[model samples]
Target chain A: MAESKWTPKEPMVSAKDVHKSFGDLEVLKGVSMDVMKGDCVCVIGPSGSGKSTYIRCINALNPIDSGSIEVEGQEVNDPHLDKLELRKKVGMVFQQYNLFPHKTALENIMMAPMRVLKEPKDEVETRARELIKKVRLEGKEDSFPGELSGGQQQRVAIARSLAMRPDVMLFDEVTAALDPETVKEVLVTIRDLAEEGMTCILVTHEMGFAREVANHIYFTDRGVIVEHGPPKTFFTKAKDPRTKEFLSQIL
Target chain B: MSARTLIPGITARATTDLPVLKPFKGKPYGHDEIGFSRFLANLSPWAVVCVVMLLALWPMAAMAQAKYTIGDAFDALWKWVPFLVTKGFALNILISVTTMAIGTAAGVLLGLWQISPHPAIQKTAWAVTQAFRNSPWLVLLFIVMLAFPFEITIAGVTIPIPDWMKAVFGLSLPIMANISEVVRGAIQSVPTGQWEASESLAFSRNQTLWRIILPQCFKRMIPPWMNWYAILTMATPLVSLLGVEEIVTLSRQAMEGENNHPELLIPFYGFCLVIFFAYCYPIARWTISLERKFSVKL
Candidate 1:
């Protein structure tokens, strides 16, 4: 394969020694990682392992205590940073989907582009319809989030994020809430996006999907990265005992 | 054949005396034995009103010393009906509508302030809400009526602040506070994920609140808002204490104009009750239906 000879481009998203705490509990302890453009990095870990926290920091959702996170050369941790601009570039899909309950699926996809980006209505509608098709939610455009199934809602959420035309996508356990049967559908949608060369960081528990779709896999334990490598080496020959124990339990 | 003969262990006296198990009669133990009382118990609201009017006026009609009978009092009420409705009840509705408008507008802002990120703004909003919410509506009305000037001159232009207007401002204070709570509750009831989701989408706080948060809250707020309007309309009669000339005050004046007969009290007050009930009952029912309709499944 040409994978071995391929060189990484400049990092599109970089986090250095990120530290964050919630009151007395520290969630991320000096965590750091980098993603080149179009790199699919899957972060896998047990519950409360800071995998979600680290990715959330990239989009400025959870403010870090003592670290620097930059996206596209913009300082995310800076107090004066334009968070709106930062978030526009970094789209995030949460576990619960969180699509607006009042709006239909189409309106949910159209909202951010029209309201935040102030895009033309007709143009946004056209693109939004295309996103709906991309997420395989074509006929469900008029359905509200409450009316759709969990997997379908998650896909619509993905489409909603894509409406803003973000440079990078963050998936924080997007499939964790789905039924076992529906998990595959969502995973397939996400895998297609990753294969299409979207710069993506996924904090997930689906180890098999992570192994199959991600180029690099990061294993975090106790608020820090225990081990990380390309999917083949990382999954088969993990060096750290902690990573081995976690992989053994989940797999 | 006696039960004693049919069964092996039976006593003929006990079996025969066991009040022949007749077909199930009305209520057990003769609780509703009187047909008239049963009819009274089952009366609808309008039926009850009719029965009450008859019972109350029957004695007055039979009073030997009474010069003006119940019929005369009702005739006087009929004479004053047009005036009471147009001038008095209209003002009540007007005050309620105006107060609701002002209260809702101010309350929404106050409610948003309660959830503001700044501690100072949030605390101040909370303090104001608690203060007004805990205060008596009547006391607030009195304070507003007594404290505000009837008219004020601004840059040599005189603007008259009428008494009813003051009443509206007074009534709106408590309504504002309560509506503020409604708004705050509705906004908070929306899952936090919504805020995070909007934030992740790069929506500004104002944009998220106006476009996303408020639209959802609007539906939830309606039932309670209509509830407050009903309560406020009922309380509009309180303004009559300060002589704002609403239905109650007008009814009293109509009685005085009709020689102030003692018999006039029931018919006049009953008219007020019927009109207010007629107006507010539908709103209360509608509020309940709306509450059911807008209830979020989640």
Candidate 2:
């Protein structure tokens, strides 16, 4: 196994012995991982491998049954933890855009900032417009999500998450739902964020994007991290038989 | 479609400025310069209304000679309608508005309670709402009307609860119960992704409901709400059984006035039908329009 190049300083997110189950089906079996500041970690695995569940646990979106997760010194697994407050520090983007159908692209980006942050409308509008432009949805600001294409809507979703100025972003198959031609735009937007040093944890099937954007590659299966290392070695020199098997099918 | 047509300033700047058209640059049309076609278009709405009214009243006119003339029935209507407006119709409006206000507020609370995180609270609210919803409106009204006293002592002082108040309370109980179902349905109709997206944004449960979920629900609830309101309005006539002197009571009194001719009975009842259709038709149309406007895919 190749060692991680970046040494841990102030870990942005740390999950220890995290386990989650859906009734009798145990999805997460004592999975553990750490995401440090500015680390672009890509989580990869097969279907029902708990890849999505593990990342969701980091933000306490999926409540862990055992073990703990801490993000920016906030104990996410605490019984009294303020989920709303914890979520503000971590922005999440899903495979489905989930943009408010009623709201315009600009409004979708502006909503959380104005309502949750209680920021001034003018300030939020300025940042939201900037983010919309950043997402390459400049002229489409007034358009509603229903009017936009899949790629455009996904970009708006990214901009909406970025509008909160989150410290860490969790992307769960952000581009998985996109059409082939439109997928590039969303990947490029995420690549821009990763290059900007935004601490991101992504569960994705795009091996090429993962190799390019993610510094650390974690191979997860049946709810645990079976192997993790630098992308160069993890892809080319994976030690585990399972990682090799998973990579073989995908790559 | 061109910008020049929309903003006449462009035309004014483009051509030699005419004093006649310059003053009306921003207005829809210039005064005393009406186009014949545009004037016809403007009058179309009033013409349509007149045609419909004529068609509606024609049936009464054709049946006029058979009994009391339609003219006499209308004259009687003119007299009794004003009397009913001040005495009976006003009460209907009051009962309807009051019931809607009180019922909607109580319903929202009960509906939210039904979905409360606590299992006990949820089940309790569910049971109470279900009980109220399952009971017939008239039966429920009768029970309240018969069970409660006219006055109740509170802090050594008696507060009078009049018959109308009893009727209002009775009407509101079922309204509240039905509205609760509407509220529950509307909330449930919102997709789970909306909740997840809003929650992931760090919005509190209340915030998510009020800002994200409820706004979307408001659209889904409107058509059903308006339908319920129309039903409630028609049911207000039932309060006449409790001697409330509402529209139905006044209609009976009006019919009794012309008992000698008795043939006027159909016209009197027809008047009530017209009143109800006049009130409900627009509401139904408006609800449909709003449904189309606010339709969400997910």
Candidate 3:
């Protein structure tokens, strides 16, 4: 609870005693984690685990029923850091791709930059096109989400998030909806992102991806994190029995 | 479980020709107890009965048709369609378009409101939508006309907004009612994951509603909305009560000879049919195309 004098650069995102409940159901029970400036954290857990809710709290997507979340050194519980600001800093991609179906891939990338960010047209267009190229979706800029395959749409989603030049990116099972063979294309895009040091927190079942891309990996169970450590130690020899059980089940 | 639809390249792969195709190969029509065969067998008598009913209803249909003549209807349509480009048919068009625009905007807002996180907003929206949906549109028109005769004022021109205005207002309220529910239903129909994703992006409630929710709802809306427009067009005659000098009113004048002679009824309405169909056919076809396009997307 003590604030350090130097502030420690206010880890890109920090949550403390974050509790969120919907009706009588408790989704996250006092979750707290610190994500450094450019660290990649992969969250692994079973279906009902709070991985998704935890990240959403950081962006103020799903309000933390009772908790404090901070992004870029500012407290999120206040009315000041509205969704638009948090979203600008913490962009997210969905497991189902969630690309706007009616918009072209280029427009999807350009919209937030133009509308929410209020960036000028030419600059946004250029940056959006560059983002499309980053995700290996250069030629498919004008194509709608429905026109693209599942993997392509997911990549487009990734491009859309990246278009805003966010300080952090959130991925909720980015490739889970993709065909088996198409999964690698999306993972490859994320890998390229991780290599460039874009701060990322991923909720994924892909153990190989976690082991490869994440600097730190956290395994959660029943709304609580059972293990947290560097990927090698956590994936190979987590101290908790739950993590081992999960690894076994997933493997 | 056993009966299959004979649809080939879709439900059936083998049954190419209908004549030799066995009945069991067809798809299930409905009802678990009675498969397509039994259902068809049961429907045979109904079909015969309906044919007889259709024969019986022919006279009524003929009588309805006899109310309007083509010549009188044409005279009515020609007089109105071109006469008052700003005040007559065009005014109806403007009024309908304006009413629909306002109603659609309000309805969409109401629809989104019905799903708001706040209990008060949602409940209030639900009640309003239900009331609008339940209240007769004609009653609404009459009520607006009657209720506003003393209240609404404009630039010191207190010309008690006529029944025509009431008709437009009344009709629009119901349209707004239906549109709001339609908007809400369509928004609800979308996957919950959309809200989750929008939340993750941290779009405000308004942004999420406009960007994520409403655009997705448009596909679901196209069909019902088009149907509403077509039905609204049919109900345009109802506006004549407000004395809007609409097409039907023109038809009545032409039919009655405006010479004070009570003319025959058949030619009177017959003229109406041609005018209505001529205007409505293209819109109906457009709606059909839009429905097909959206259906494919869904």
Model 3 chain A lDDT-worst window of ten: A1-10
TM-score of candidate 2 versus the correct structure, residues matched by position:
0.79
TM-score values for chain B across all models: 0.82, 0.71, 0.66
By TM-score: ranked, best first = 1, 2, 3
Model 3 accuracy (lDDT, Cα): 0.73
lDDT of 1 by residue, B72-181 (tens): 88899999999999999999999999999999999988998999999999999999999999999999999999999999999999999999999999999999998898
TM-score of each: 0.87, 0.79, 0.74
Q: CA shift at A206, candidate 2, in angstroms?
A: 0.5
Q: Candidate 2 residues B17-85, lDDT tens each? A: 343443645543111111222232234344545654565477576666676666676677777877766
Docking class of predicted structure 2: acceptable
Model 3 iRMS (Å) reads 2.1
- Between candidates 2 and 3, the DockQ winner: 3
lDDT of 1 by residue, A114-156 (tens): 9899999999999999999998988999999889999999999
What is the clash count for each candidate, in the order shown? Answer: 0, 0, 18
How much is A94 displaced in model 1, in angstroms? 0.9
lDDT of 3 by residue, A1-251 (tens): 32324254668778888888888989888877889987999999999898888876777767777778888776778765555666777888887888777789998888777777688999999998888888888789889888999999999888888877888898988878889999999999998888888889999989998898899998888787778999878877777888888888878
> Which residue runs does candidate 2 get wrong by more than 4 Å?
A1-10, A239-241, B1-86, B148-161, B255-267, B296-298
DockQ of 1: 0.58
**Alpha-carbon shift of residue B258 in model 2 (angstroms):** 4.7
Report the Cα lDDT for residue A16, model 2: 85
Pick by DockQ: 1 or 3, better one: 1
